[model samples]
Target chain A: MTLTGEFFAFMSLALVAVIGGVLLLNLTKVIHMVVALVFTFVSIAGIYVLLSAEFVAVVQVMIYSGAITIIMLFGIMLTRHHGEEAEPKGGGLRKLLLFLGVLGFGAAVYLGIYDLNFEAVPNTLHENNTEQIGISLYSQYIIPFELTSVILLVALVGAIVLARKDDEKEGDKE
Target chain B: MSSVPVSAFLALALILFCIGLYGALTKRNTVIVLISIELMLNAVNINLVTFSKYGVNPSITGQVFALFAIAVAAAEAAVGLAILIALYRNRRTVNIDEMNQLKN
Candidate 1:
């Protein structure tokens, strides 16, 4: 592949994304880790744009980078005073083993895809991309779309119920 | 633009997935574990969108699937945070290792 602008874009985005993930892994402070992940999520959105998925890219920015990260911070804030992720005795050994296992898993998967190629069929997904997704969601995927709304509602109610302070339990504890 | 091979995208996803896996498995903080899981899901979304564009059957279906995945992930985050809050209320700690009430 000749060095083109697209290649450069993909390269830079992927580098930033990888660095973000690495920082998330290595960062000591949980809040700092969350901040690092914003970079990864945003870079992935850029990757989506490179793949001609403008609508999905925008959604990724809104949902993952914006909504979910904020929700996580809220979770952390409510929980309060979580010190550094302290490693237990012999935990360093466990972490090393896990890292090796993950590396092996990644290598195995990479071996399968390192030579992956497909016939380049020029398609018009880039043009009116949002329109295509909307049409598909409404027509072919109408049922699942509606079901997603139902699931979201259920999750909303369930979260409220699960998180509500129980006066009787509080009385018992007191 | 087409010069960037499908494998490059696939490799990126794989690397991210491995990082997520390692983080989820090793991190003791419950919220960070949840965050790592989110990273794993994000990696899968990348793979889905990549295949949507460059796979044998290039269609808009993959993008639709990615959208649904995003919705489900959002719901998951909400519920997970709620559960974390409740767990912290009872246990007063966010360490995954120490919250083993069910281990007995």
Candidate 2:
């Protein structure tokens, strides 16, 4: 296909994804927000597929849509009060200012990058990219990977400790 | 159909990321904040995978990293919700503003 046509297609998909994300953000009901977020993740996976990362796109759906969203839903179910009204908090002006500040910062960064005519080194996609990645991970990046595992282990322990009830302490005393 | 440009993918990821950030900052519910964080993480994954596909010879690294990220996110969700559950058990409130034990 022509570059112009491709750009138009991408633009449309991007627009849809962006609109979905915004809807997720603006919705007051938490459950609706979660549903919108699922849409956002799926659309992003579509973008990944369009970029030619079919493997990554599938993993995106498998993990984010399958696991993380379900986790968030469980959290919501555990936390939300049954049929209670959401409390109203007033800070509209401050929120608006913060939002505008973020927008300005983003615009400035984009413009600055655009002005700099940076050239990227072109690389072609290979069939054995996944194998190469595995080789590198097991060889050069193994230490960091191990460290990440250890960090996750520590987080798990900490979480369990934090969640432990003090009833045990009272039981020991008794 | 023509191939999609990398820029379009990046732009969508950026917008999703920003909205996630906004939700994280503005939302009071802990669950919502966690979901927003997941959104941001997914945005990063999209960028990594897109670059891997179009800009690199070995495209597998991005997907591998994305997998690692998914694992981390799952761990995070489990631990975060566990903590939230504990907190709810003790205080019966999930509002960040109300959980100020260290505000000396």
Candidate 3:
């Protein structure tokens, strides 16, 4: 096997994503975990670029790293007094069980992938990735697209409803 | 030069999924658990995009699916955090372990 720029890029991005994920797991501070998650999201966007999914890459960066991360930070700030103080509960047996479960799942997936023979087809790239995506999204997968929009609208209303202070209603009554 | 094998992408996604799973299971903070769920969603996105690129058809369908997944994930995160905020307001705690009010 020969080394190439693509391989090197993939390796670097994978390292970033994996390390960021590990940090998100290990970090005690909620804010720090969000920052680490941002790193992972950004690197995943980079990987999308390598996959020639430029539109997805941009969306990943704009949505995941930009919008989602900001929303999480805001959630952390508005909800908690000191967002950095929460620590994992100390339970030796529970921790061991979780560790074992996660490990088993990972090992199973790794073995499954290893044993499966997948033909590596040469990736075909389109000149206009965004156009192709838009065409397919609107035409072939139109229903799901519309449903996703509805889901977002519901989420927006739900967030407002769920987070609004209940005392506001009582205050208005007075 | 051989293009980055599809297996590499699979491996990356698998690693990410496991990490997310571990965090979701072990972390006491509700915020971290939400973030872990996002990580897992991202891993799924990676898989979708990878298959789209290297699959027999090599179509844009996978990317479209990934887009929908991203949107849904964002919505889920928003609602999840909102719920967390409301829970914190009533309970004064964000630790999942202590969120046992409904348990009894």
lDDT of 2 by residue, A1-174 (tens): 366755675776677678778887677777888888787778777776666566667777888888778877877787755423255377587679768876776576466433332234454434555566568679877887897798789778877786676556647989
After superposition, which runs of candidate 2 have C-alpha atoms over 4 Å from their true positions? A1-9, A82-88, A113-129, A166-174, B1-3, B56-60
Alpha-carbon runs more than 4 Å astray in model 3? A81-90, A115-117, A120-123, A169-174
Enumerate residue pairs that collide in model 3: none
Fraction of native Cα contacts kept in each candidate?
Answer: 0.86, 0.48, 0.74
Candidate achieving the largest lDDT:
1
Q: Give the per-residue Cα lDDT of candidate 1 at A152.
A: 100
Highest DockQ scorer: 1
Tens-place lDDT digits, model 1, residues B11-102? 99999999899989988888999999999999999999999999999999999999999999999999999888889988889988788888
Candidate 2 to truth, TM: 0.82
RMSD of each: 1.4, 3.4, 1.9
Candidate 1: stretches off by over 4 Å: A165-168, A171-174
Q: Of the pair 1 and 3, which is ahead by DockQ?
A: 1
lDDT of 1 by residue, A1-174 (tens): 999999999999999999999999999988999999999999999999999999999999999999999999998887776457676668877887888899899989998999999999888899999999999999999999999999999999999998986646888889
Residue A118 shift from truth in candidate 3, angstroms:
3.4
Provide the interface RMSD of candidate 1 in angstroms, 1 decimal place.
1.0
Model 3 Cα interface RMS deviation (Å)? 1.8
Query: Highest TM-score: which candidate?
Result: 1
